[model samples]
Target: MCRLFAITSELPCSPMTAITALDVMKEGHDGSGVGLFMTDLAGPWEEFKGAPILSGIFTNKGLKQLDHYMMELGFTTKYKLSIKLPKAPPPGVPKRDVYLIRAYDYPESWEGLSQEEVNHRLMMIRLQLRQMGLDTGDMVVFSFWPDVIMIKEIGDPMTVAEYLGLDRKELRARVIMAQGRQNTNYAINLYACHPFFIQGIATMTNGENTAFVPIREFLESRGFPGYIGYQSDSEVFTHILHYMYYKLGFGIEMYKHLITPLQDRDLECHPNGSFLRHIKHTCRRLTIDGPNCVIGVLPDKTMFMVQDRKKLRPGVVGGKPGMWAFSSEICGLDAAIPDRDKSKDFQPMYLDTAVVGSDRKEVKIWRQTEPLPLQL
Candidate 1:
């Protein structure tokens, strides 16, 4: 099993806080890999919320290719956070020529484009860069989205954080999601790491995805380019979210319905029972049947956690007014924010979806049996 840790706050906090939490739950996961996805960025990145930022590792040659390609596309570099590694990295951490988090200004021609159009272009550019790097193993692009940054590497969580110099004040954010991977289902691959992202949605999961094949087939058949990669079976969870919420124009709550729909008898008493039944039949291919616990952040910065129908994995949400954490273990939560009221801590069951909005005011548990609000 892998350990998942996520935190959201009204004020910017250091990524080290999340990393430390992951360290506390170290026994739950093997030290094979670690991944971090952050948004509502603060520090130096706060001023460039509209600029597209690219996060990834690159070889010396690949860096040149990226520079040339961006210039050809009329994109200009606005700012860059280039990591300076020690001469000798931690024992298990791999050595790389460049680890970059760069923000870029859009092409002059895109000045008046809609946000949706710009988002499409950014995804396309990221895909192209990924393919280019894959051909020669020069670059490994993770994400190219506004106000988001993703860092992934093969090493223990704490060691990777220190090696990457993640303690810097400039690397703060209002929301952060991390995973310490155990590599139970596949070989160790950076792309297979958790905290997968597409467009603006991001998610990480703990537990096996026994129903991976069918879900992958259903998503790949959607004729969407972004749904192509399946380095990890768990990645389908993130794409499934983007499909339901973005492509189908459904509310975020609909995501819980799509992945873990109610049984026939239970649906009979639901207010939207008829519509939900139709959804279950037409979208049956999307339902997941494995033991999994998911933690994610929506485009609006709302953080949420949900469990598989069996509730086989452990999860807890706890914190105070300005901050909240959704962790795979209670110990991890204690490490992230210990001063919060432990009495109010919540452990979501099979039918529960624990959510904390961007305001970070309170934790609301939305249950499967409850009718969703009209306005979402």
Candidate 2:
């Protein structure tokens, strides 16, 4: 089993808050790896909020090639932030040549393109660079998007945090998700880490994904360029979300319905049972079969959690004013928000979709509708 921790704050906060929570749940996950994803970034990143920031590691030569390539493509660096760490790498952690967070201006030709077009372009660039990095084995482009950054390493969560100098880095964000991954589905590959991202959607899971093959096949069939990698079965969750919302036009709440469709009797109790029934029949192949708990974020900063139909995984949601925390263990939340309102804490069952809106200002729980009391 693995441990997942995520928090969204109305104010900017460091990844330490979530890292500390992970420490509390340390026993649940072995010290195999750590992965983090942040959005609505703050601190020194505030000024570059609208610019696309490319986060990655590069060798000395790779950095030069990267700069030359970006220049050739008409991109110019507006700001650059390098995470300064010791020359000597930490024990068991892979040595990084260069840790960079760079903001860039799009090519002149893309100046007036629609946001959708720009997003597609970013995805294409990231995919190309990622494949290039794979071939060279000297650079890794984790993410390239506006106000989003992903960092993954092979080490204990706390140790990776210290090695990265996270506390002194001054990197802060309104939303952050981290996972202390205990690899069971794949070897200890860096790309297999949690907090997977494609475009603006991000997700991390704490349990196995028995339903991965079909889901991967389905997403790949969509002809989306970003759907090729499946280093980890959990990656499918993020694509599932991207497909449901961006492609099919379903609202976030409907994600739970699509992933775990209700039984026929329960489906008939829904207010819009007719519409849902059609979706179930048409998208049946997309349903997930696993004992998993999924936590994810959308481009709009909305954070949500859902569990498989069996509810085999442990998940709890807790919050106070201006903040909400989700974790695989209640103790993890307790450690993060010691003064939180325990009365407001709740565990999501199989059919619940718990959402924390942008800035953590709103909390909502959408439960599956059940049959009304018989007209006796």
Best by lDDT: 1
Model 1 steric clash total: 0
- What's the distance in Å from true for residue 77, model 2? 1.2
Residue 313: error of model 1 in Å? 0.7
> In angstroms, how far off is 123's CA in candidate 2?
0.4
For model 1, residues 1-376, the per-residue Cα lDDT tens digits are 9999999998898899999999999999998999999999999998999899999999999999999999999999999998998988888888899998999998999988998888889999999999999898999999999999999999999999989989998899999999999986456789999999999999999988889999999999999889988988899999999998888888667888899999999999998888889988988999998699999989999999999998999999999998999999999999988898999999998888999998899999999888867543
Off by over 4 Å in 2: 370-376
> Compared with the true structure, what per-residue lDDT tens digits does model 2 show for residues 280-312?
898787899888999999989999999999899
What Cα-based lDDT does every candidate model obtain? Answer: 0.92, 0.87
Q: Give each model a TM-score.
A: 0.98, 0.96
lDDT of residue 136 for candidate 2: 91
